[model samples]
Target chain A: MNPAPRSLTMDALQFSGTVTAAFSHDFKNTLAIIKENTGLLVDLLAMAEKGRPLDPQRLATLAERIGRQVQRADRMTAELNRFAHSADLPEAQTDLGAMLEMAVVLSARPANLKRVGLEAVTAPPLWIATFPFGLQQLLYRCIALLLDRAGSGGRIVLEADDGRPPVALRVIARTAEDRIPAGETAPTPTPEMTGLAHALQIRLDWDAAAGGWRLTWRDVET
Target chain B: MSERILIVDDETDFLEVMAERMTHRGVHVATAPSAQEALRQVEAGSFDAVILDLKMPEVDGLETLKAIKARQPEAQVILLSGQATLQDGIAAMKLGALDFLEKPADMNVLMEKIRKAQARKMLVVERRAEEKVKKIVSSRGW
Candidate 1:
């Protein structure tokens, strides 16, 4: 295969593999909870069979817990479905805020596992005609990189800044500690990250005063 | 005798439900909602076995298992994970875990493992006692 096609294929494969692995781990944890709840219910029934009175409240609570897990799994699958559909169109008018929110949800587990708080503070909803999948990849990678830099006990606040026709998004770490030192050059973006941002017509700038990197994009035809 | 087991998982529901089921089966059970809490529990009390979830928020299962073994070498640890790979199992075993079981594990199977763990723990304690007595005798030149 030619180098360009091979690179694109590899990027696609890597993105899908990572996203699927993360979602699977999340789904499995949810399933494990449901399984245990069911097991607990069964044990309760068995006890009742042996003349132990079942507490109606306890049974109700178990049922609620199972229901909650089912809903949690459903939401995760929905996010995965939306993410999969991002590649269906080459470019379209997309809600940047919603896309960023979706990326946050998709990447929340890893961030939480790192004990880093990632909160998205977006400006009023902004719609841009752009490549959705490429932007998604870029956003997810940015969050992952920030979490790695922040380590544990750190907070990262992301903002979809409203500028002129070109959109601006900021990701800032409040604390001075952590991997990305304040007032220093931005952490180097991987080749893949740079390529994704370039394809999306986005420029990355490190704002030392803001304590994070900002992504800016100029107007482009849909 | 009932086996004393500590169950650790980040999911509160899973922890509570498993603890209840194990208690119903005549095992003395304690639950920790996170690996950090599990370490605190390990430091506070000894258990015949520890049923630890592989994936947790911080201080993952393998790391937690190492800490447990360091603090209490005699503690038998059984790792439970929904996303455990072959490498993870091997690493867990190398870190002194008694067994690695996947999530949604059969309760009966787990019960059997716990019983075996309890028996093995008893043997470990007995062997340690024998070694200690032997060392004391030689040191005293008695």
Candidate 2:
């Protein structure tokens, strides 16, 4: 493959890997919680064996807690399932809000590490035709860049402007301190971001006044 | 005296469950929902072992480990990560963590690690005591 193509391929793989790692971590934590709960139940049984009366209500609540965790794990895996299949097609009709939602969830692990909040605000649903994986990569890069600039104790609120035809996204950093560094017109995009943005055909505009980032896609076949 | 273990994780379910299980095993266990709380707990009471979750919202596991070791040099730390990489494990070990274990960890394995951590803590405490005794003896020329 050509160098550019290879580089883009690697970028895609890296994006997928990052998301998978976060998802796997979440899944493991979920299982850990469940395992601990089950172990607690076993302990309770052991206590009962030792002539300590087992509260029927406590047993019921424990069972319910385990059930709740099972459901939580099921939802997480379902989101992960959809995320895994995002690249099944090179391009598809994708919901703008859902896409951003996935980006928020996947990038949350790192955002939390930096003490930055990443939230997907409610937006009117709009479907657009584009490369799902490429768009995801672009969003991921944008969020990563935002976090880097935001530093610790910052928040990035993401919402879509549905009034517009292209449905532009507004990723606003809640704190003014996280705004673009002094004298910098915009946040610098990493090489991967440049490559993915070029491939996906999207534009990023830094609004210093708004203290956030805005992404506009004009080639959408809505 | 029974072993006093401190469990720290953001997930309440995990912390509650782990605390209950360890308590049932006759180990005196305390739980912290966040690294900050864990730091406070460590300052308030010395523990034989600290089981810290790697990923947290504000203060991460590495930072927490550093703080704990600073406050209590003899304290033994065992890090737990849901998806720990080799590099993560190496970093934790270099930071003086007794061990790094992946999440959904086997109970038997964890119990064994806790025992080892307790032993390591004892050795560290004893070594410090010995140094203090030597210092005193030298100061008295005895």
Q: Which has the greatest DockQ?
A: 2
Stretches of candidate 1 off by over 4 Å are: A1-8, A176-185
Summarize candidate 2's per-residue lDDT along A68-162 as a digit string, tens digits: 89998898888889888888998888888898888887788889887888888867778877788788788877787777566677777788886
Q: Give Cα distance to truth, residue A64, candidate 2, Å.
A: 2.1
TM-score to true structure, per model: 0.92, 0.91
Q: Which stretches of candidate 2 lie over 4 Å from their true place?
A: A1-6, A148-153, A176-185, A219-221
What are the per-residue Cα lDDT tens digits for candidate 2 across B1-142?
Answer: 5788999999888888888788777789999988889999999998999999999976889999999999998899999999899998999999999999999998889888888888888888899999999999999999
CAPRI classification of candidate 2: medium
> After aligning candidate 1 to the native by TM-score, how far in Å is the CA of B72 from where it should be?
0.8
True interface contacts retained by model 1: 0.74
lDDT of 1 by residue, A111-184 (tens): 88888887788667788888788887788777777775566888777788654555788877754354444444
Model 2 DockQ (Cα-based): 0.75
**Weakest lDDT window of 10 consecutive positions for candidate 1 chain B:** B11-20
